[model samples]
Target: MNVFPRLPDNLTGGLRRPNQVRRDQLEGAVREALSRQVAVTRPLTADPAGQAIRRANRIRRRRAGVGIALGVVTTVLIGAGMTHLSGGSDQQGPPIVVIGDPDLSAQPLATASVAPPPPPPPPSSKASADALFASALIDADGKRLALPGVGPAELAHRLPNGTGLLVVGAPTAAGRSLWVAQDDGLVQVLLAGAGQIVLAPDATQVAWRDGEDLLVAGVVGTQLIGTVRIAVPDSAQPVRFVGSSLLVRPDPTRPGHVLWRPGADKLTEVPEQDTLNVYGSLPDGRLVSQVSANSADGTCLALVDPLRATKAARTACGTRLSPDGVGGMSDDGRWLLVNGKVGSTDRSLLVDLERLGTTLDAVPVGPAVSGAVAWTSDSDVAYVDSSGWLVRLNVKRVRAGEPAEQTPVAGIEPGDRPVLVSGS
Candidate 1:
């Protein structure tokens, strides 16, 4: 009986039926080939001469089979735009066939074999772009079905687009620890280190300060793949991420004020302006700031891209920039909430930083609204009130001539566990 039925010519890749027996057969074939390599590298020389000869013959036959199987697998992989095996290995063990390199001069060959035809050219960027919408689908049990070897509990955060980045921390022999995660849940380790990590919007890499020099690490499959250090001043604050781009703020006393470093390739600077206090860079390349110089009657909010002011305007009405305090920007760059001052009293203002730099409304959260002001990607802001209540303030309705209402979003007291609010 035929142990294996031939797969149909019409059965395209990635279209195989679930739990298909052929898939297991293919995996076993590859495993057998790998086992042969291991056996050759660890030869059993203590066996009887007859047994040793038999083992050697078996190794030779298996090696030949592996060479042939490898060629077919390589062809299939190349056609699918997957990774190609590296050309060489540094170990002194018996050789294995690799796809790209033609000159097999390192090891003696028992026999020659035909190389499969090369794969076709890659698809156009437009087509490739459409096909690259990677996503992870999680079941009700909080388990991600598509990502291998990861549970929902392990995920630190999921991007708006659904790609998840997981971090696993383990202690070293000496007592220190390291954490690593796969970048975009692919084979790349996004970060593996002892320092703090900040993932960019693209989720491919991160910017971290190892010590004095700021280093950017590429992620590959729950590991820190590689790192490149960027030149930064000693006085420069620790690294921050603005969509995978590094935002380096040079010392205020230094010649240049704000330096934006995108990966290892470029370092851009915003000319030192007397009025601008470089707060930080937004993912869309805008700066979330309050005006310090020039036309400084009220707080100044500006949109800067590539270190240039794309749009500059002052906020209106109750939204006056507080001299002693500041706040946050919405995820979409649509709003900037400033803890402004109304006369001698300090208040919070929800500034509509999108259409116009106008104060949408102002809410009196009292003076105790000091710590970190939380903006939940929407127009709402949350802060811990003095009465020990986590209050959410929302600019519910703002009409042309109507006063903006300051209503309690949801009050969380000591008893009820405050639900974590995030995302748009």
Candidate 2:
């Protein structure tokens, strides 16, 4: 389309030669912009987005690809008065824009700022189209622990000291069920339709929802002894354990989160925490959850005080908080690993709960918020990246505000979701 209508003979009559020269210069500028823009948009390596088109080509079948969005550039060629343009969004660097027509020769091509290729897929963090989980769980030392349990075995969260585990899988004699594992054996339990089962911080107690009943039992050796079943309110489910007390939700239709003490006959609503969803708890009586839905600040990680419901919380919507009650919190209740957004892409956020404002590193998590992640220690975390390699990193540097690398430990197999055996 013609951006500028042809200047009439009357307008160019007095300056035909100069106008002819100007039109030629503009034509040259448009050609140059088109070439540079093409180079920027070309899929040289041909990746997909979620970081999908970017990730579908990653080490494995990760929905959201590892974040190489650090170099996204948007170039538009409208007309002559305005020409070359590029730069990324929200961030300071790429995806820049040029408004209003200006001198073409005096300006440089923004496309000159091409981004370097994504660091060669993090060495060992590559997976295949068919890759799944490893045969068994992996420990901090990178050793695979294949359970003696027959058929399919998916470890949910490792028990205290990696002594036992909670396994879930396809239908068995136990029906669509949950199992308790120790050594090489598997004992099926109820909670037929449930999610990550949680244990007490001390590991002396275990909790789960069996039908409408919330069962609190003693973890003795491989068996659950002295089981006490407290029928929860209709539709309520057990989420995480704090001290000897269990945090239950009276179904999603309910307003506040419920905390049922060991022998309590009823659910106690945690004051001021009515809007929070408890995912982790601290020995000091604090709780972990996402920001309240009623909040105008948008979603991020938040802490709830069980004792005194008020505190000057730090909030940042730029990066989100991802983990739930599963293997989300650390042994000491200080560091947390969750899925969050780094700019416009999905990434894992290794957050130092004690320092929420500063150490929320927007690290790349292969599976956007899906897949499996387990914590091996307060300073170390393990997970199978999008590439299907089990990686362990010293979270010490990350918590202390330093750089931490996901050191590749072992390659993961297709259909095998690996978890840190000694899940803290």
Candidate 3:
């Protein structure tokens, strides 16, 4: 305590002044000692601000390098992923590649075993005319020689092949049974109580009327496949075959309606506004009918599509007494045979259906006709004269306005009415 010097008490406010001087002396000595120590421990470096800036720059460089390295790693990973997805690999063996949905379990793909469609069927062939007629005619003695259980056939129609014939009214009870005669001397009874038999154009089918019921039978070669009965109006009468279908008309009691069967199953009635008489059927299922005009004495011809019977086309055949009689179409469907009285003379006219508006006024080749007529072929027509003689007329020459040459058919004799069947 005595080693320290004291200041003047009067100038420093006594005891407080002496303590303050001692404190100031001690603080100055400590400050000098700390300055010397700091000087001896300090490192040889640049300014503090420069060092801080350099440290900040180093931090930024480290971050950028880390980012670059991370980017390189990500790029390499992406490249490897793309290569794997693209089926590219560094392995020597074949690479394993997966297709379809990744979330779905792998399955073996199903294979389809499809069979090719069957080849189309071959087209059918048609028979010749001479071959057909040869099968129909009887022997020289005019007797039913080949057909058994048949006596004196009234009407004979040849089948498509020359080996078979369809004969009607063999000398049986009521003359109603139909018989099929073959060239091999085999005979079969096709139907009983049958009338008005008609063969289809293809000769694969036949239709007939048994009183009020209509029967259709299918034929293959010389055998009858089956017969189907179709119910029709009691007044309907079978007229002709429109292809494999059958066309029928009402009797005089029911004049306007016409019925047809698509097959042997059912009948479809044709509607008519006025009284119409069906004369012939076209190959395409159209009907040629006689329609009355303003006067009762006059009539016109109309072409009607049976499927659409409401639509009818009236042609120039509306003259007085024209088409007084109805006939049939030729085998080729080119000519239509129509009969009418021209100036008190019974005349046969051939309408050229193929030529549209052309009509041929046929000259009588034989005696006056008895209204019985049939088409033998595309170019020929056969008609019965009043004397019951059959006359064959050339249709082509008649259409050209030239006189139709007529020839007498040998088998048809005088006083015997004939039914002409054409071999198409």
Candidate 4:
């Protein structure tokens, strides 16, 4: 009765407290989780000034730690191409971390470029040979010599093999007569109606044009054997040999040329061409011709496809040549002798092909007597002078302002025009 009413016994039983041991275990687990979530070394003091000072010190230490980490990141970045940064919630800026070894420096891709092939090697050691000056076969010493089986001829050219000479006579009703002046002095007259005779540069083959028939044969020790006749489409004149292929002009008035193999029927025409007739070929297969039109004076020489068939490829022009002067390339194709005029005088100029495609200037040896010009040696150029003497001019001597060595080649006055031999 006092001031409140009495509680029921059953209510007291239902209001029992939680188990003490379980409650203690649960409280400990909650305390451990709170401790992990927030770490604290010491509790804050009740003084406001002390708490403010402690907070300032903690901030300064954190800034110093981040600075040290940034220094480490900068050192590593010096040796790495790139780096990454990982910042935590508590940090203002984080250090960059590097992974595996990476390229220290990056560069751009390279550009493509190609270089042209080099020129052919020089010839082997010089050989003892004879010079043909105005139809007269003369030795290197400029003495008139005679081939045993052959007599005076109209035109002649040296065989590339230096084995003999190719002699041709005036064209009669039966056509021009041809013969090979052997090294052993045996002359072999050509068989099978050979005309327009053109010998291969290798000296292993010979070819001629007979009507529409193109006759090619193997040269076996001064003999033209194993003849193969192929029918061509036109009256092609044999021009010159570019390796095993024969270069022919389809028409004398045409501006181009075609190449044909002896054993095949296919014809290959040069890609870019002009009216210049290819009279000589380099061992590398470039064509050398005469370009007279639109030049300064005399005759201008040109080099076609110095590299290949592209308009960007250049054409080199030589200096003025004699109006009707003689010119020929050396056997090694290293030097070019053009009958050129300096002033009122005709001089045999040496165009050093080693400096070809660069200059048009030439080295004048002297006045040539006969129109014939030939290479006497790798370094010597031979020509007949006004005294009918064979002048051998060493290029080095001529370059040094020295005189040419003259030898008595012939004593004839005139009427010996048709019997000349040369490598022209």
Candidates' C-alpha lDDT: 0.44, 0.52, 0.54, 0.58
State the lDDT of candidate 3 residue by residue for 326-404, as single tens digits. Answer: 5657766667666655667766666666554312223333344444355555676666555544556676566556664
Candidate 1 lDDT over residue span 249-365, tens digit each = 556453234554544555666533433443445556655555543444554554455456443433333355665444556666666566666776666665555555354355444
Q: How would you order the candidates by lDDT, starting with the best?
A: 4, 3, 2, 1
TM-score list, all predictions: 0.44, 0.55, 0.56, 0.57
Worst 10 residues of 1 by lDDT: 95-104
Cα RMSD (angstroms) for every candidate in the order listed: 28.7, 33.6, 26.0, 25.4
Candidate of highest TM-score: 4
Put down candidate 2 lDDT per residue, 1-424, tens digits, no spaces.
Answer: 9999786674554554444557788999999999898878555474444466455466553433333332232222233213322111112222221111111123321322223222212112322101112355565556554432223644455555554565554445543444454422223342344433555655567666555667776655444555666777677777668776787777665545778887678777766554445657766777766654444434555566755657424443455544333336677787766765566665556666776662234454334433355565666666655544555556756545655455444555665555544444
Model 4 scores a TM of: 0.57
Instruction: Enumerate clash totals for all models, in the order shown.
Output: 12, 27, 0, 3
By summed lDDT, the worst window of 10 consecutive residues in model 4 runs over 96-105
Query: Per-residue lDDT tens digits of candidate 4, residues 153-261?
Result: 5456677767676665545565555666544323346532345766665456767777777777776654555566667757678766777778777776656677777
TM-score between candidate 1 and the true structure: 0.44
Candidate 3, residue 173: lDDT: 53
- What TM-score would you give candidate 3 relative to the actual structure? 0.56
Which residue pairs in candidate 4 collide?
A: 134-420, 135-419, 135-420
RMSD of 3: 26.0
Question: How far does residue 10 in candidate 4 sit from its true spot (Å)?
Answer: 99
Q: Which residue segments of model 2 deviate by more than 4 Å?
A: 1-134, 154-196, 253-255, 273-276, 293-297, 307-318, 323-327, 357-373, 396-412
